[model samples]
Target: MAVYTYTVDNANLAVQDLSTGESLTDIFTYTITDSDGDTATTTLTITIDGVNDGAQQGAMKSKSWSQA
Candidate 1:
């Protein structure tokens, strides 16, 4: 297993390569406090999907394709 951390601007969010072997979901919380004793909070969700990345080595037994 591995862990990755990222820093982003306040209006930008992005994630990639999250469908590898170790698919998992995580929640991150951020809090900001202003000088006038005001505060704001934000929540972000990180989700990783499980997908087979390896290719078939043998002859093609069957195949199918689709688009949505």
Candidate 2:
């Protein structure tokens, strides 16, 4: 099975979130102006899938007895 997972690494993500609304707005505007900014700065998504695998079988035991 092939699943897709995204790994995100944004050092400034937490700091940006902690910043105020005005700060965010200014950051956004500056980001637009500076094309080299962290455009995709933060959270990533992972896709998890469920696959169907057939049932399994168990082992069996046998015994033999003799009488006289």
Candidate 3:
């Protein structure tokens, strides 16, 4: 089991926790909002190392990947 961390970006929203059947120890959930008033949700799945971060240790994982 691993840890999944991420932050929702938009305008203003609430934080939540969700389990998408991914094999992980800890999981973080956030809400996405739209200042312009958009009625849709943007799913940000935090992965191990996204954006090719040099020091991904302190980076957010917002991506989706098939469990192995």
The number of the candidate with the highest lDDT is 1
| Of candidates 3 and 2, the better by TM-score | 2
TM-score for each predicted model, relative to the true structure: 0.39, 0.24, 0.20
Q: RMSD, each candidate, Å? A: 12.8, 18.7, 18.2
**C-alpha positional error of residue 48 in candidate 1 after TM-score superposition, expressed in Å:** 1.0
lDDT of 1 by residue, 1-68 (tens): 32558553323222233345655566889777878999889887876555554666783588789999
| lDDT for residue 9 in candidate 1, whole number 0-100 | 32
lDDT per residue, candidate 2, 1-68, as tens digits? 32544443334554323422322221111212234664534333343332333344663467899998
Candidate 3 segments whose C-alpha is farther than 4 A from its true place: 1-24, 39-68
- TM-score, model 1 to reference: 0.39
Candidate 2 clash pair list: none
**Stretches of model 2 off by over 4 angstroms after superposition:** 1-40, 59-68
Q: Which residues of candidate 1, in runs, are more than 4 Å off?
A: 1-23, 35-37, 55-68
